[model samples]
Each structure stands twice: as structure tokens, then as C-alpha cells.
Target: MTLIGRTHAREIETLSLDSADTRNALSAALVGELADALTDCAGDAGVRAVVLTHTGSTFCAGADLRDPPHPDALVGLLRQIVTLRKPVLARITGHVRAGGLGLLAACDLAVASTRSDFAFTEVRIGVAPAVISLTVLPRTDPRALARHYLTGARFDAAEAVRTGLLTAAGDDVDAVLEPILDGLRRSSPQGLAETKQLLTAKVLEAFDRDAADLTALSARLFSSPQAREGMTAFLERRDPSWAV
Candidate 1:
């Protein structure tokens, strides 16, 4: 079954994460499908911009415990988003957690509804937000990320924008994105691609310098004892032994 639903109109392509059954978790198949779709968008001259959105209440709930993608694959997917020639924008109106924030950060622009909430949930699962930091650290405020990364607390859309996680948030997400999409529609394809490259240089640098280390770290942590206990407890709907 297809996990991504695609639609295009007026040169704008919309890719929706359609795996609501798993809360659109980053399963291996989902990741691979998304990567291929993105590559197609990147090569299509008729596609002016891409909108990454989701079908369910949760935009994404991080890596799928049942069928997670390899750490290296996750890193590559994030890098692809950061380096995609045409602009990629995230249109969110739901909760985002853990690795999903990495996807949001990789996008050139992100807008969400005021109702959306976000959290870095990796720490609760006995893993750091290691792989995601490549794109996230480059995009967000260090101090804000420090607190959220360590505590795994939930923050609202306004706080997300203040911390540079979101470009804007509003009562109506579509209303918020319309003007931005109009601007993109007006922009020359070459102008958008070149400007996006100029904007994403530092983000790509982070991927170049730190991706290998972070991917290794993520793989190690996910295989460790603590993560096993955390995952088990999470599936069982109980607290891990480390929880107070």
C-alpha cells in the first residue's frame, strides 16, 4: 500500500504522509517512499515547490519502533530535503515529535496551525535526538533546543516560531501558507533554487561534518539496553525503570 499521497496543481506539489494507522511514523518503507517522491519532485521542472504535510492528527511520531528505518537512511533523507533544488515547505496542523522535528527543520519554510504541538521525545526513549541535530541545530535556537532536547517537554506553535522551528503559526494554517505559496509561485525557478542553496549552505555543512557521527550514535543508542526497556515500557503503556 502507498504511504505517500501526491497531488499537484499550479506548479505546486503536495506530498501527504498518509500512514495514519501508524501515526505516520518513520518506518523503513515510508522513508524510502518519501525519498523517492522527493527525488522525483527535485527533477521535475514543472514542480515549482513541494509541500510536505500529513493526513492525521499527528504529523509524525518519530521512528516506528516496529519497523524503524536505518539511522543512515534517516540521515540521508534529511540531507536530501536540505539540498533539494526547489524549495520544500512543511505545512503542519498536528502534533510533531522526535524525528519529525528533523523533517520540519530540513524544510526551507514551515508553517503550522496554532493548535499544533511539538516535542523532542527521543530522550524519553533513552536516546538522544542525535541524527536530527544535523538539520535541527542549524535551524533552531541553541538555548531553546538545549532545554527541549534535555527535558523532552511539549511546546506550542508560537514557541516553535520564536525558537526558529516554524516560520509562522496561525488559527488557520492554509490562510497562513497562502501568501507564502503565492510568493513561491511568482518566483523564477532558477531564482528559487539558487536562493534555497544560498539559504541552506550551513545546514548542508552540518550534514557533511556531523552526519556520520550522529548516525552512529543513533544506531548505538537504539540498540542499547535502556532503549530496549524504554521501548518495551512504551509499548506496554508503563514507565521504564529509569522513570521516577
Candidate 2:
């Protein structure tokens, strides 16, 4: 776990999710570390841009289901990123799926390698991608979300870009990252902060009301028979007819 911040070409902060074996799952510890790091970066006057890249072959596999943190803990970390003043960039190089995609969706800018993949596997695990809905839903088209949410399907870099989740999908990791970093440098740090604030303001406005809706929806969703049936069917290698 490394959160390094500096000022040279620009104010920069990076989250080094160095858990190679876990592919950088958002465990409680990691989320705590990230929350602290993001705060440090946002607080620094010199830091203009942020690069959120991970170590090893994969970017992040989301959260390890073995220990899903308390909803407050996980949502707390995301709320920081969502409200951060500095621009944040997600630099992806390898496989991204399930909760990993949720983390990427939190970033304002995503630059992924051509070889990388994007997937939402929550439904397959018998749960919906509810937390990520706030970040990804607004970015993705209605039809695309409908398709992906229905099947918990996998899509590649191109589809990710077309769906508006990724800003640039390049042939490799370095190529994808360079332009984004450069673009951030060229823009005014103050302007970036203002724009980010504007975005955050709008998101937060809806978020307060929508959060209540999400809690209600998730409570009903998890407690319902449909969720149990869906989980069983998924484990049994069959389809779920939720509307049934």
C-alpha cells in the first residue's frame, strides 16, 4: 500500500494497490489507505493531477468477497473520490471486472490498455452492482447499462470507451496514460478544481436523494425471493427470470 504525492511537472498522487495475489481488491485496509491518500492529495496545494494505477498485471479485481467491508466504510472511500477537488485518473493495464469496474468508474478519467477488459460480474454473484450504479450509470448509455446489467456481461476496451466510461483506450498502458497526464498538466489546476467541484455538486445533489432510494431498493432487492432464486440459478449454471 503506497500513496505517494509530489509536485514536479504537476501535483500528482498515486495509489499503489500492490496486492499482487489479490489483484488489488478493495479490502477495508486498502480503502482506509486510499481514503487517507486521497485526502492528502486533495489537501496539498501543489498537487494538480492524480494517477491511480496499480501494481502487477491487473489493475483491480474490485473487493474480495471473503470480507466485504461495512457499507459505510466502502461508501466513505468512494465519497472522497467523488468529492475530490483535483482531477483523478484511472490507469488500467490488465483485467478489470466486477467491483474493479466500480472503482474505475469512480475516476473522472479512465485510460485503459487495448488488451484490458471491463466486466460487471455482480449479477452472476447474486447481487447487483448497486454501489457502482452511481458512478457508472451516469456515464454509460441507458441501452448499454440495460444490456450489461441484465447479463453481467464482459466487454473490452473499445466498448468501454463507446459506452463513455473510458476517455481513451489505447493499444497499451503507457500510450493510454501519457496523453491523459499531459492533458491534465495543460489545464489550469484551479479550473480543474472548479470543474470537479461543479461535477461533484451536481452528483452530490442527486446523490443525497438517490442514496435513500438505493438503500430502499437494495434492502428490498436482497430480502426478496427473487435475489435468492437468482443466486441459486447463477450457481446452478442457469438463467434467472427476475421478472417472473
Query: On a 0 to 100 scale, what is the lDDT of residue 222 in model 1?
Result: 95
Over 4 Å off in model 2, which ranges?
1-10, 215-244
lDDT of each: 0.95, 0.74
Q: Put down candidate 1 lDDT per residue, 1-244, tens digits, no spaces.
A: 9999999999999999999999999999999999999999988999999999999899999999999999989998999998999999999999999999999999999999999999998989899999999999988999998999999999999999999999999999999999999999999999999999999999988988998999899989999999999999988999989998
Give a tens-digit lDDT track for model 2, residues 1-244: 3523233454566666677777787777777777878888877887887788887887877766545555566666666778888888888888887767767877888888998887787676567777667677777778987898888777889988998878888887777687777777789978998998877675566566566566455556655777777756755788877533
TM-score of 1: 0.99
Q: After TM-score superposition, what is the CA distance of residue 90 in candidate 1 from its true location, in Å? A: 0.4
Candidate 2 has a TM-score of: 0.84
Q: State which candidate has the highest TM-score.
A: 1
lDDT of 1: 0.95
